[model samples]
Every structure is written in C-alpha cells, then in structure tokens.
Target: MWPEGIGTGAGSLPGADPREAAALVTGETPEFPALPELPHRSVGADMIGRTAGLLVDLAVEVVPTGWRVTPRTGRDLRRARDLMSADLDAFDDACDRTRPGWVKIAVAGPWTLAASVELASGHRVLTDHGAVREFAASLAEGLREHVAEVAERTGARVVVQLDEPGLPAVIAGSLPTASGYGTVRAVRAPDAQDTLRELIAGIDAPVVVHCCADVPPIRLLAGAGAAAVGIDATRPAFTGATARVEALDAIGETWDSGVPLLLGLLPGTAPRREPAIADLARTGYDLADRLGFDRRRLARLAVPTPACGLAGATPDWARRALALSRELGKAFADPDEVPAGGAGPA
Candidate 1:
C-alpha cells in the first residue's frame, strides 16, 4: 500500500496540538502521510481511548485501573468522541489545499482492545469470549463508517492500520488479571488468527497489522490476511548479534510470501548520539542480507518507520525522526545516495 520514497509515523506524536501534528506529519511524509495521533492531549487521545471512540453502540468509561465497558455513554466516552472529532476536523483542514493520495489511520486491533478494557465485573473483556466477540463486531461496523467518512473528507484511499501492541501478551497469557493476582489464560494462535481474519475481512480497505513486540507473530498476521506487517526491526529479535534465528526465519518467510513489511528502523526518541542516514538504515540492510534477499529488494519490500510511537520524544526529535524516516525510504530505494554527515543534534 506504500509508495516509493515514502515513510510513516507509528500513530502517536508528542504534542497535544492536532493541527500542528497533522501539518507536521503531512508536510514531512507528503506521499503517504499518517493521521497523526496526539495522545498527549488527554486519556481520550491515547491508543485505546481513540479506538474506543469508534465503537458503534458500545461505550467505555475510565476506571481507576483503565477503561471499562459501561451500560450508558458517559463523560469519558463523550470526551473521547470529541477529541476524535477535533482530530478529523484538524486533519481535514490540514489537507484542504492538497490532499494525499493515501492516508493511514491507526486503530487498536481486537485483541489489544479486548486485553485493555475491563468488563463491568472488573475482569478483562478478553476473559469473556462473548463480550470480546461483541466488541469486535461493534468495532468492525464502526470502522466501516469511520473509514468512509475519512475518505469522503480527504478524497484519498484510506488504509487501516490495526495497532496490536498487546497481541504478544495475549498470545503468551502474560497480562495480569484485574486483581493482579493471576495471569489470563493464553489465547490459541488459531483462535487469535481467526478473529483477526474476520476483522480484516470486515474492513473495506487493506489492513496493516502492526505489533511492536520483541517477537511479533509474523506468521499469524500473514495467515490472517494482513496486507502488510509492521514490526520493530531495532528489537533484539530482529537485529544485532543476539537476534533470534526463529525471528529471522519468520521475517524471511513473510517476505518470501510477498507481504511487504513496515520496518521500524528509526529511534522513537532522541538517541544518545546522532546517526547517519546509513547508520539508521543498517539493520534493514542487514536483515535483507541475512534473509538471502538482494539488498535492492528492500526498496520494494519494506516501508521505513520509527521504532514505535513518538509520544515519548521531544517535539523536535519527533519531527526530525519522521523526516529521517522519509530519507531512509529514499536510501532504501537507492543506497548510493545517503548524505555524508550524521543527522544533526537531538
């Protein structure tokens, strides 16, 4: 779904100003800009809260622990909705003069949302199969409408990015229970795949499944019919001397299957040392080398991204990181053109 010389941010930016955030992302990655997510605004603007705003009939309220399912819509859900509405307004205005051909919008995947929100009884929604299924259905229907509205407003093909940062924990049963006394039961790979598949099938546009875990389920995402898989290449599972053989093998297999990877290569926050364009891109090159693919294949098979969200970054670094990611995209397309010096000070 990505174009040449293009890169994208991983949803969240550091600032609270939606107008500025939208302008910055679009100005930096004009070809395929993402709808900048400003989590710093408030709890409603965070990943879970933002996605919760897209529920059709269901509503959520913030509890002492986190978001919880509610019988009736409350102030928390209203605030979330208002924040989302404002973002859409800001994004629409930002693109008023010249709209991008494609815009990526990120939402929490079913598994992540289920794992995050608590039920009325205080257990995770994922703990009850029926409740989770209902939420997924609501999300699917809501997303269809949301996508249509964005498409109409921006006049661009909308690409849905399902951010599943919680998927690994769900698969491994590592999430603490509401009581924090025991772990939830592990979800079977097949079951998880099936739910994801159904959700993807429901969406009108192509879906990119993003999981920035130490070892995201590349095979499972591919099996679930993801058009692209987003991964953190800087993680030990995918890079460095300690990289896992299995992780490399899975990544190689996914590439061999012709599913492009959204490779997270740039630092999300300010690095201790400034890095050259070539330096920041080394892991992607090494990954291709280890996979036995031609170095040039990276240009077509990978889309560069920051290591994760920029919520923790300084505003300057966040902008610079997106700019660098775009430069890396060009470098991947033509390795000979890397600039001479390091990317300037943090």
Candidate 2:
C-alpha cells in the first residue's frame, strides 16, 4: 500500500467580484490559495492557471471543444498550451518557495478522448482503430513534452493521471454504436489494454488511471503497468449487500495484483458537523476491513477524499471539507492521543 495524498479536481480561480474570471495568461490577481473560492464561469486555462497559482502539486485540464472543429480551434489550442506552460512556471516557483515530493498532471485518456473529440468529417476517431492509435501516440508525445516542462520548471518528479470515465462504458458495449455519423465499434479488452500500455510506455512519468465510474477493468489496468487505480469507493456501482461483498472481494484481488487502490471516501457535499471527522475515519476503516485489508494499512492504501470534486459545493463547504480531510488524515496517522468523538481542531 502506498501512502498517496488525497486529491480533488481543480479548484475555482480567484476572480473579480467573485464572479468575473481573470485572464489566465495575464491577470494581476495574487496567487490563489489552497481553499475553495466562489464559482465563476471559467475555461480550462483559467482552471489550470489558478490551480498552478495555488501551488497544487498536481492538476488536471479538461478543455472545452466542439464536436466539430470551430473557427477558434487554433486559438483554443494555443490558449491551452500557453496556460499549461504558465502553470508549469507557477509549479516551479512553488517548488522553490515550498518544496513538495512530487507533482501530477492529468488528461482525458486516449480512448475517451477519441470518443469525445470529433474529426472534420463529424465522425469520432474511435471507429478507426488505426487513427485512434495514432491519436493516442500523439497525445502521449504531447503529454511527454508537458511532463518535461513541469519537471524542468519544478525539479520534481512528475506523475501522469489519465481520466477515463468512459472506460467501463466502452468495455460494457454501452457506448452508442457508431451510426451514419460514425461506425460505433466496441474495443476488445485486450486491444484496449495494449493501447493503454503503449500510451503509458511512451510517457516517462509514472501513470495512474482514474475512473469515477464502476470498478474499471482492474486486472487490465494493473497489467498495463499503471502504478495505481482511482475509484469512487463511497458510491460504488454494485447494487445490494451481496454485490457489495463481491465487489470488495474483487478489489482485494486487484490489490493482490500489485496496483494499489486510491479509495475515495469523502462525501461529494461537505459535511455540516466538524465531528464528522470520526465518521470519516470509521468509513475508511470499514472500507479497508471489507476489502480484506488491515486497518493499519488504511493509512497506506486509502487516500481519504471527496467522492468527487467540490466544484459544485459552496465555497464555505469546500473549505470545510478540505480542512476536515487534512485533520482526519492526521487523526488516521496518530489516533491514540486525539479525542475520540470531537471535531478537535480542524
């Protein structure tokens, strides 16, 4: 079990009037703090800029794009590149100011990207395996360059996380069939596994794949050489008590395969009571026990986190959640002297 840090999706950027987005490339706003902020309409660059400004060691970028290429396509790409570069600069400055162990950068995985990013002919590249492979290779190269930029700026090791919410869907053949718009074809498990392995092999950084959906192709992910798999543990896809039991068994098997699991335990919404710290600890312990792992291993394998990002939460709630998470982590590490049922000093 690895003692990985808890993670959240990118936080909101500092803005004018708590609603106006600052130009990511050129804004005079002070570096954003680690706490959450008032939600303002923001683009991918704004999110990345603010995240980097906050000194977050790791962040993910989800740029918006049309199904078909638009008039501002080149501009959008340029903006994205510039924003990423700026974030790398910010990351470097943070490393100089407050050194951290490692930094992470995440992007949508190739298969999911192929499904989402449409071509000029209004067809998803997923239909063409050759094109999809090429797209994956290109993305890998782009990500490698980005990783190198971050590493050069920060002088810290880089880890790449690939967000693949659509993986389970693709495996289950639930993704819509390619019709006249495109030929929708399901990727075989082995082929998908090989493609992911190639993508990971191409990048120099350690790779992690995140699926907020059901237990992903766990064995496949492990086989693909991913260091870890992130899943929404609090709200698992299995139904009923029996299914839950079975799911735990499966997770244990996956762990046995050597890929550590990053179990998400935080609620999507922030909790009201500070005393919820105890509940959080208990939840972590319970999940570990059910998964056939020892409670002591909890601090190692389990990264207590909100089931998802706090973007939808109010600023107050998000701040509270982060504070609570840090506090509970401390408790998990050393609980003997801490008060058993109180919020303590979060």
Model 2, 1-346: lDDT tens per residue?
Answer: 2233333332333332321221221121112122223234334343332222222122223333333323333444444555555555554554555444455566778777767655555566676777677667767777777778767765557767776777777766565643544336678989889999998998888887777775666667778888777777766543325346556765677677767665555555645545466666766666666667776655556445455555566555655555555555555565453455554223
Q: Which sections of candidate 1 miss by over 4 Å?
A: 339-346
Report the C-alpha lDDT of model 1 over 1-346, residue by residue, as the tens digit: 6576678887689988889988988888877788888888888998999999999889899999999999999998889889999999988888775578988899999999999999999999999999989999999999999999999999889989999999989999999998889999999999999999999999999899999988999999988999999999889888779899999998999999999888998888898776778777777788998999987888888999997899999999899889988888988898767655455434
Which ranges of candidate 2 are over 4 A from the true structure?
Answer: 1-73, 177-183, 237-243, 272-275, 335-346
Q: Where is model 2 poorest over a 10-residue stretch in terms of lDDT?
A: 25-34
- TM-score, candidate number 2: 0.76
RMSD to native, candidate 2: 6.8
lDDT of 1 at 319: 91
- In model 1, residue pairs whose N, Cα or C atoms come closer than 3 Å (at least 3 residues apart or on different chains), thus clashing, are none
Winner by lDDT: 1
Model 1 weakest lDDT span, ten residues long: 337-346
Best by TM-score: 1
